[model samples]
Target: MCTYLKNMANYKHSHLKNKSFEEIQMLFNNTLKWIESFVPMDTELVKGSEKVAKGCSKRATYKLEQEDAKRQRIEEENESVE
Candidate 1:
C-alpha cells in the first residue's frame, strides 16, 4: 500500500493535470477512503502513542545534553592547560 502511494507520488503534476475529471475525482475520493480505513481514528490511542514518543524525545534530549556537557568539560580542561 505504501509502495503504491510512493509510486503514485512519482506521477508528475502535469500527468495528473492531464487526467480526466472522473479519474481525478476517483483519486481524490480514494484518498479520503484510504484515510478513513487506514487511520486508527481513536483519540485516546493517538494521545497515548504521542506520549510515548514524547518520552523518547525527552530521553534523547537529556542524553545529548549530557554528551555536550562532557565535551565542554573536556574542552575547558584542555584550555586550562594552555
Candidate 2:
C-alpha cells in the first residue's frame, strides 16, 4: 500500500512539471502578441518621455544661467564700492 501511494505521488509530480512548462510557453506567446499589438503606442510613450526629460533639463540650465548672472552683477557692484 505504501509503495502504491509513493508511485502515485511521483506520477502527480511528473504531471505537474510537464503542465508548468506548457503554461510558461503559453504565457510567453501571449505576452509577445500583446506587445506586438501595442508597439506603436509604446514607441510614442517612450518618445514623449524623452521630450519631457529634455524640456526639464533645458529649464534647469536656464535657471542656473540666471543665477550665475545675478552673482556676477553682485560681484561687480561690490568691486566698484571698493
Candidate 3:
C-alpha cells in the first residue's frame, strides 16, 4: 500500500511538471500580448530618437572641428609672429 501511494505521488508530480512547461509558455504569451496592447510598438519613436542622436553627434563633431581649426589658426599666427 505504501509503495502504491508513492507511485501515485510520483505520477502526479511528473504530470504537474509536464503541465508546468505549457503553463509557463501560456503565461509568457499572455503577458507579452497584454504589454503590447498598452505600449503598441512604435517605429517612429525609435526613428525619431535615432535622428536626434545623429543630429547631436553631428553637432558635437562640428563644434570640435571648429575649435581645432581656431586653435590651429592661433598657433599659425603665433608662429608667424615669432
Candidate maximizing TM-score: 1
Across 1-82, the per-residue lDDT of candidate 2 in tens digits comes to 2233225323344433545656645645655576566646458787998899999999999999999999999999999999
Q: Compute the lDDT of residue 48 as modeled in candidate 3.
A: 82
**Candidate No. with top lDDT:** 1
RMSD of each: 7.7, 12.3, 12.5
Tens digits of lDDT, candidate 1, 14-35: 6576678787667766865876
**lDDT values, one for every candidate:** 0.73, 0.66, 0.65
TM-score of each: 0.56, 0.49, 0.48
In the range 1-82, model 3's lDDT, one tens digit per residue, is 2233235323344434545666645645655576565633467777788889999999999999999999999999999999
Q: Candidate 3, residue 23: CA error in Å? A: 24
Give the CA lDDT, 0 to 100, for residue 18 in model 1: 66
lDDT minimum window of 10 residues, candidate 3: 1-10
